[model samples]
Target: MNILVLCTGNSARSILGEAIFNQLGAGRVRAYSAGSRPKGVPHPGALRLLERRGIDTNSFRSKSWHEFTGPDAPPIDIAITVCGNAAGEACPVFPGTPIRAHWGLPDPADVDGSKAEVDAAFEATWLALTARVAAFLALPFEKLDPRELADHLAEFGRMEGAA
Candidate 1:
């Protein structure tokens, strides 16, 4: 399965979700991320947390959702929105009917504190997103129909850290 994680900024939460999904999904799913308004680069705190976890930050960059609009873009089987703004915005998770789920989270980049506190907020966001991604990776995707899969994804959105 191919998945796309979306957020307004694509700087923090969406980036974290992308990493978590890609790492845990292994070769079972290909995950990508984008934003309604690209931030150009990822948030420093997010990059820090990812690097600390030994996940390569070199391939990550804040990008627009339009990049996936081209005919050459990979087909998305699922599209997850991690923030309200992107969830509400017009998304092009097209070419087919892809399951959509919202896993809204408070932006760690919006946290105000010293280095440690800021890093802690990022860590918390990471953990929350990790939980949802891991749950999806654990599901028996081959058996579930589209409706069942959608229901499960919606249930996951209501888990901890839900906004």
Candidate 2:
């Protein structure tokens, strides 16, 4: 399945999500991430966190959702919003009418104070996203109908760290 993760900035949570899903999906799922209003760069803290997890940070970038709206865009099987802002905002129409869900998370970039504190916030975000993504991968994708799949996706949003 091709999955898309979204957020307002696309720099932190969504970027981390793309990395985690791609890493953990083990070839069963392909994931991408975009933002409503991109910040033009991935957050430094997010990159640091992903690198610590052994994810190649070079492939991730902050991009706009418009990239997925074109006829030539990759067909997205699912779209997940990782922040409350993106969840409530207007989004581009995906090419394949992908299943949608909101896995709201607090923006780790919004955390203030020392470097250690900032890293801690990003770590927490990573843990929460990891849990939700693991739950998604555990689903019986081959047997579940579209409605059932969407229902299962929605339940992932309500897991720990829900915003």
Candidate 3:
């Protein structure tokens, strides 16, 4: 399955979601991320967090959703908005009418504090997404009907943060 994760900035939450999905998906799912207004580079703290998890931070980048709208773009099996801003913004209609889900998360980049505090926010968001994604992968992908899959995906989004 090909998935596209989106945010307003594409710097933190969305970037982390892309990396986590790519790692946890384990080649069965191809994950990509883009933003409505990209930050031009992945957030340094996001890079550090992924590095701590031993996931490669190289391919992650901040890009525009337009990159996925062209004819040559990869067909996204799913498109997820990782923040409320991007979720509310107008998005390009992807080819194939991919399943769209809103995994609303607080933007770590918006956190105002010292470096350590900022890092903590990013870590929290990362953990929340990881939990939801892990649950998502546990589903019986081949057996579920589209309506069932959509329901499952939406349920994944509604999951609260881990205690």
lDDT of each: 0.91, 0.93, 0.89
lDDT of 3 by residue, 33-113 (tens): 999999999988899898889987878889999999999999998899989889999999788888888889888888888
> What's model 2's TM-score?
0.98
TM-score of each: 0.97, 0.98, 0.95
| Clashing pairs for predicted structure model 3, backbone only | none
lDDT of 2 by residue, 1-163 (tens): 9999999999999999999999999999999999999999999999999888888888889999999999888999999999999999988889878889999999999999898999999999999999999998998786788899999989999998899
Q: 1 or 3: which has the higher TM-score?
A: 1
Tens digit per residue, CA lDDT, model 1, 1-163? 9899999989999999989988998889989999999899999999999999999999999999888777888898899999989989989747678889999988899999999999999999999998998888789986899999999999999999898
Task: Compute the lDDT of residue 5 as modeled in candidate 3.
Answer: 94
Q: After superposition, how far is residue 54 of candidate 2 from its true place, in Å?
A: 1.1
Error of 3 at 101 (Å): 0.6
TM-score of 3: 0.95
Regions more than 4 Å wrong, model 1: none
Error of 3 at 95 (Å): 1.3
Best by lDDT: 2
Badly placed stretches (over 4 Å) of model 2 are none
- Candidate 3 residue-wise lDDT at 31: 91
Instruction: Predict model 1's lDDT versus the native.
Output: 0.91
